[model samples]
Target: MFLVYVDESGDTGLVNSPSNYFCLSAIVVHESHWQTTLNSVIGFRKELRASYGFKLREEIHCSHFIHKPGDFQRIPKSLRLRLLRDVIDFQASLLNYQIVNMVVNKKNKSLNSDIFSLAWQTLIQRIENTLYHHNFIGSNNATDSALLFVDKTDEIKLRNLTRRMRRYNPVPNSFNLGSGYRMMPTQWVIEDAIHRDSAHSYFI
Candidate 1:
């Protein structure tokens, strides 16, 4: 089994929006390595607490951390940059997980386009394809089932989209001679995505 943690950046709005692109990122970790991976993250957070007086439970919002907003104001800019670099290095050092990311350019999209749905659909398809081919841990034949945990920003919309896809997802039939799509219901992912508050869940 695998646990998939998902988060998004930017807004779905195409007009007068702060960002022109929307990105969805997923971190996939196998069941066998989940505990060790979590322990490593907790250890890293403890290191931050000891070195910079950062709280272990404090959520690390990238924008606020970089901009030094609110509670982050006391942290010097130079230390913030160093901390960011350390985070990058730590993430790079992890070997038991996979990162899947999808970005939608809203600049060229129509005003009526559903940017959120499109981005999630593509991302889910990519994840499904990956799991179908490789769902093993070392020599063990683990179950290919995966569970998704997303930041609770659009619970209803995301749940509906995921449920619909599980029922009747379609994909291009590359093996066919003609241009046609084929039903490809989700196989690896189980049930609707479980939403969580990012502030509460360190994994999110």
Candidate 2:
């Protein structure tokens, strides 16, 4: 089994919105190393707290930590750079993990459906492709099942979208116009929708 933890950045609103881009990011981890990965993340957070006086309870959002002037602002520039560099290093050191990101430019074209839903559709397609590749390439240890975990902030909306995708194909007919009889990948997703609060979702 594998776990695909997802989180999004930016609002779906296009009018009077601050962000120009919306992104859906998923961190895929195999079941065998799940506990170790969780522990390593917790330990990294603890290290940050001890060494940099960073708050453990606060989430490590990239934009807020790097661009905005708040919690990380009080720290020296050199230290901030060091902390971020170390974080990148730690992420690179992880084994059997994959980070998949889908970024959309909200202003590029008019969307047929809500931006959030479209983003989810694209994300699911990418995930399905990953699973398909894995099943074919890693035949000896092919993944049998996978679960998706999303931030609980938009639980209702996310759950509704998941249910809709599971019940019927959401991909537009226009997408498959060129490819004959190509099925969309949403069916591979598990029906149960799991939501976790970002405050406690360290692995996400």
Say which candidate scores most in lDDT. 1
TM-score to native of every candidate shown: 0.92, 0.83
User: Relative to the true structure, how large is the alpha-carbon lDDT of every model?
Assistant: 0.85, 0.75
Question: In model 2, where do residues sit more than 4 Å from their true spots?
Answer: 111-113, 135-140, 170-181
Q: What are the runs in model 1 whose C-alpha is more than 4 Å off?
A: 135-142, 174-178
> For candidate 1, lDDT tens digit of each residue in 1-204?
788999999989988999999999899888889899899999999998887777888887778887645787778877877877888899999878888999999999998999999999999988888878884332245456889999966888888888998889988878655788989998888888988888877778
Candidate topping TM-score:
1
Tens-place lDDT digits, model 2, residues 22-116: 88888888777789888898898899988887787877766666678486788776777777788889899877678889998899747553788
TM-score (C-alpha) between model 1 and the true structure: 0.92
